[model samples]
Target: MPVQKENVSTAISSDGGSGVSSDRLQAVARGDNIPAEVHKSVFETTPVLKINAFNLWYGTKQVIHNISMPIPRNQITALVGPSGCGKSTLLRSVNRMNDLIQNVHIAGDMQLNGDSIYDSRMDVIDLRKRMGMVFQKPNPFPMSIFENVVYALRIDGEKNRSVLEEVCEISLRGAALWDEVKDCLNDSALKLSGGQQQRLCIARAVAAEPEVLLLDEPCSALDPIATGKIEDLIQELRGQYSVLMVTHNMQQASRTSDYTAFLYLGRLIEYGPTSDIFTNPVLRETESYVTGRFG
Candidate 1:
């Protein structure tokens, strides 16, 4: 297979957990603000997203190779690749959205907290709750702004007025949109601007307290200023939640992520700390792409 471009994994057969393997994918341990050597702290004690020998196929076309990597807790991990290289495909795999496709076949193991999410016994709803997704375009409900954030919580069986309002407030604040829309909670969400609506979607994602937040080209729809606002929001979200974003913008990946993984034709060519990946890549493909050699 050219660069791990195996068949795309089918969500029906996939556990949908994230990461490469427990041992190889865990977050690097023992860093003091930063570390000098990338390989020394290879041993990981805690990891939030783990995948092992994962392969996927959309009917007959393979997308992701036998890719493996660990997502550190409460930090941003960016997936960068050229168009049609399966960046979005791999991101969707994390939450099992691939199952919605017509023909899908998934192979390999994915784990969360050492539990197999692909196992048939796993609760799909709960699994989705643990992994929230924010799309490129904001898709707020037609209802009031308040309902947009409260909708997910309502589904999770929280009917209490007080609890719902509290979650709404906290989630909006977490998404950096509360103060802007706090006064018009009852207003229709459509009245908001593009950036505001995107933040609203983010608020909606966080309302359920998801463990990992998946963002698919979220800022591609916004302008520079709005993009900055979303970037700032991601930084604020780091300490409280894990974030995985797929983007073609190299600058955005450099600015926002703690770790960066470069994929070429669906195979992960390199994965490492953002600083090293940007400043001094260990792989030839990464160097070429980062240095404008080729994508």
Candidate 2:
């Protein structure tokens, strides 16, 4: 059975938890200077990406506040929050996607595998090449399935047909789509169904052998069955790639992620093991949000 929100509250209340005080919760709601309640276990795992006091602003309005968190290597870390809470903004910051926008300024820094992402001499293209990103919707290229999967290699000047073919099969298999599309390798990727297209996109992302996978609501646009498949695929990728995902689905976050970070008003609230965050979060605000009480 699906874990219910009341069950989570009950589990916490049974331990004599009094929950967050109204004054503290009011302070958080007022955007007061409250330090993030990051769990120490967040630092116990080896981090593939380190976000240090990161902040962002669009024109004059600030969106992301001072936030610091480590994305553990080879594990799924989920960013969960209500709408307009800067989850996607923070995710985009990791790969400098926010750089595309005009008048967007940032403070602080993020390090990918110990290399500074905001360095003046950093190659944005090269930096992006180290990570693969999938958007909310499936975006299969206007090309054949084989081409779509091997597009990364092709652009990098890979000309060996045997090598491209090998990577294509391996990537598709890795995404659990090879068995479905093996016979139709030359077919246009657009001809596939929504789920297949999303899986094809995953295959394309993995084809590059990126150090990290960035998924922004990867399953939101799909049906229940498709969502399940994507969730399963994400779990299967746990040991092979470090995944940083932004998802609004509380259930999905609890189901697929090892660590969960709760973001509110662009500030990191609480981050810890998924089980603890759902069952015993240190803040009442977090519990209220996780349960069906509020966004």
Candidate 3:
């Protein structure tokens, strides 16, 4: 049996759930905006992360449809879409961040390295440890810079001072903030500039050595210079870690991602290599959205 795409404008169901319109989604996918020569190419490499038949709802409002995609290992995949299209919802779902919200229900399967993440035996604390997340704003703790970077390590019962220092230095350098904040390791993290604070947060996330990193509009609140620094850091982190970022900035998506997925009204409309999606999209809606015709 074929899976049906829901419409965006469907009325609320008797169960008080909002359903996604696959018709709209398929229409976008089959739309005529894409060039003829470019076809969706399959990557032979194994994916480190995969989602299949995924769906989610806040109370009765379903925000994510039956999304299925694979996030390749050692590569950057950007999720680009309009506001309220469930981009953040999906990002947070990967690490089970959505569990924090009240009345949040999730369905479908999300796997890491072929292991089910929602299994009853799955330890969320351990799951989160494998994946790091950076938010839209720079949220540094009130503690000193050094403490901020290695906070996770301390919480995990690492007591060696030398080990903490080494990890702190490495993480900060990985986040491109070592040179700027090396001398002020004892200073309060909150006192740093917005850009510095954000980098510090990244350093903190990387300190735990997570295999995958999730970023939710990490630069939306930053200036061009700060954003560029984050971008460079992401570029540097590629191949060493799998990075999945949700970004509204088209240029940033184009500049940073190897592959791109565009979502509309909470459904995946198009996904492919960045070059193909941006230069020669296979869907008319994708072309229109990417070309600024309509979001």
Best by lDDT: 2
Model 2 Cα lDDT, one tens digit per residue, 1-295: 4322221222234467754334444666787988888888888899999999999999999999999999999999999998999999999999999999999999999999999999999999999999999999999999999999999999999999999999999999999999999999999999999999999999999999999999999999999999999999999999999999999999999999999999988999889899989998877678878985667
lDDT of 1: 0.78
- Which lDDT values do the candidates have, in the order given? 0.78, 0.91, 0.83
**Most accurate candidate by TM-score:** 2
* Model 2: lowest-lDDT 10 consecutive positions: 2-11
Prediction-by-prediction clash tally: 19, 0, 8
Runs off by more than 4 Å, candidate 1: 1-45
List runs of model 3 lying over 4 Å from the truth: 1-43
Rank candidates by lDDT, best first: 2, 3, 1
Ranking by TM-score: 2, 3, 1
Extract clashing residue pairs from model 3.
Answer: 5-21, 5-22, 5-23, 6-20, 6-21, 6-22, 7-21, 33-284
Residue 38 in model 1: shift from native, Å? Answer: 9.3
Candidate 3 Cα lDDT to native:
0.83
What is the model-wide C-alpha lDDT for candidate 2?
0.91
The per-prediction CA RMSD against the true structure, in angstroms, equals 11.2, 4.9, 7.9
